[model samples]
Target: METTKRGKVPLYLWMLLGFAAGLGGGLYVNLTGQVVIPEVMEIIRSVGQIFLRLLFMLVLPLLFSALAVGVAEMGDLKSLGRVGYKTLLFTVMVSAIAVGIGLGMVNVFRPGDGVDPLLAQQLLAQGAEGASAIVGSAPQSIEAGQFFLDMIPSNVVTAASENQILPVMVFALIFGIGMVMAKSRATDQLQETLQGVFEVMMKLINLVIKLAPIAIAALMFNLAAVFGWDLLVRLGAYALVAVGAMAIHMFIVYPLLVWIFGGMNPLKFAAGVKEPFVVAFSTASSNATLPIAIKAAEENLKLPKRISRFVLTVGATANQNGTALFEGVTVLFLAQFFGIELSVGQQLIVMLVCILGGIGTAGVPAGSLPVIALILVMVGVPAEGIGLILGVDRFLDMCRTTLNVTGDLVAATVVSRGETDAVVPVDEPLPAVAPPD
Candidate 1:
């Protein structure tokens, strides 16, 4: 709710300062081998965790309200279907491109070829010790049939309470269709009420977002304190490959999509979405960054409210271009590290699974780790090899999340340009819908 004045410092600059401070402070602690470093990290970790929790607390309400209202406002089920198809198609196309870029880069770099065997062994052992903590008891494998069935929640309230986004999304879509079919005074009032709640949730998110710089500082400081420079040095090659792949996707793939599909200047698109990118990079959670993305699309990009809300809210859960790329490269890298050669056919399967996994994976920090482990096991690579990359995952996560959020905005822009009318100004109120007599 707080507004920045003309003369005062901008929020992104503060976040950048936080990042620099955390990096410098963490390096000092790591280099000095300070006896009190652990204690300091614990305090910072607690504060960072609290900030993360605050952001997550708004996710479900914001998602439900935004998605449900957006769907209902489409005026009919057919329009909603058209938009849904376009959105899904765009998400799949972009995600596949990301995976391809990652696969090519990792293969060319061959980062796993020279890993020290002893270091690999140590990392494997550490992975075994911490695997339970990372995934919280291995998930029971579910049949594909059951997985699809489970996506349709029998009880919407239960799904929402559990933060089961996919199922909650299904419910919202169905509920919105029902609203469209049975339009009445009651439905109109309900739609209005939901819109008000959505706006309130956005306001709450704005307030919570102010804590980002501090939280980012704490998170990065803890990461550096715990992992230190030695781990980074050891994993530097793999880190470079992953970061480079993401850079290519962000700079090349997305810009092209924006220019060709949206017909907008790519640099202007990037500038419009800068605030969300910074938050996504710092927070490393697309869901937490959803409200901010919506704000950017509507306010900065002047996208239609319906298009921005629907695309971005759904994209938060489904369109993880960055995660898909990271997972694909990671699986191949681990296979190489363990001297396991994946046949072309096997690698193709890995690619497919990475694309699907990106959709199912949660949009939070380290959310893809378990999926990466599972994919490794599927491809005959040791699941424990996950530890080899865990050391650098946090840093890569920051980079990839920026791409994920950016991809969402790009998808929204392209889809909106194709399907909607002229862009609406942010300050103007949405037109009222008349209740059926």
Candidate 2:
């Protein structure tokens, strides 16, 4: 029943409490140092699995309506084109910074060396098995130019059905571009439909976010009851580096970007950005956070509705700096853990994969982790290292989401200031929380 500064029991608090519960469970397990009961573990895992499935079930509809509405808000291709380019460019650059920081720290600190050799062997063996599970996997070992061709949506509905967000986004961009070409009357009709769908989705999203604390509590308890928190220690420096690098990227790198790029005061931007920031951090879905972000940008920051609608929507899809960086660092760190040396060629592959992952990874909770896992596997890294980070993923995901939206808002604000009609309102309302669809 606790509330945050903006009001209500914020979503991140629920998840954090869950994390704390899990940590406690972990501590008890480690202290006893006893064999964990298999039956109990299975029950916990089952519950966690159910919760995960619930979370996944919510992704498609939420994304489809929200993202489509987000795109449609742009009104025309010229605005869409400009916002899309800037958003993508900024996300790519920041994502590169994140991954570079992660890879650099992991390498410099040698975080993954000397992990239990047995754990390494077991994980490597398991990782290969995991790789075999990829049936219709995205292509690998392809020429660089081919990646661009492949990124286009060969089938938009298929992309949507599969919840393949990157391709869905690509389709949305093209669709929006085409919408802009149509007459304004037709566009308005389409926009109205999309908006209605979005409004309904927003209501759903708000409902789900309300349950966030419970979900977080459940997840944390299950984690504690089973694997426990001490597993993080086994990761040693790798864990430290991963969390540290992400923190630096989120709190430092992002705020700096806002200040430098927008000429806005860092503290003010950070303060003003909280409502959207908390939602992004809690839901870990910039896509989910889109409605509130647009509202905040337009209503609070007084950004022109056209600009807010345009830039914020594109930012949801293309401006994913956090995912990019997370992919970059995790892939390299996994390679280090498995003792696979990443040559210059491999590093280039890593960079390329991170860029693509940044573009492709969704804003959903722990969403990027799965896609990023696939990216690591493509580069000959052990994917099981993913499990090492998976337990903490929900928490880190919150942080990544914060960076993602903050970057977006900063982009919106900076872009708006350049326009003559852009206005900054002194009164920014608290974020709207209806339900998670």
Best by TM-score: 2
List TM-scores for all candidates, in order. Answer: 0.57, 0.60
Model 1 Cα lDDT, one tens digit per residue, 247-310: 9999998899999999889988999999999999887778889999999999999888887898
Counted clashes in each candidate structure: 0, 15
Score each candidate by Cα lDDT.
0.70, 0.60
What residue runs in model 2 are displaced by over 4 Å at the alpha carbon?
1-81, 117-119, 133-231, 278-302, 422-437
Model 1 stretches with alpha carbons more than 4 Å out: 1-79, 116-234, 421-437
What TM-score would candidate 2 get against the native? Answer: 0.60
Q: After superposition, how far is residue 397 of candidate 2 from its true place, in Å?
A: 1.8
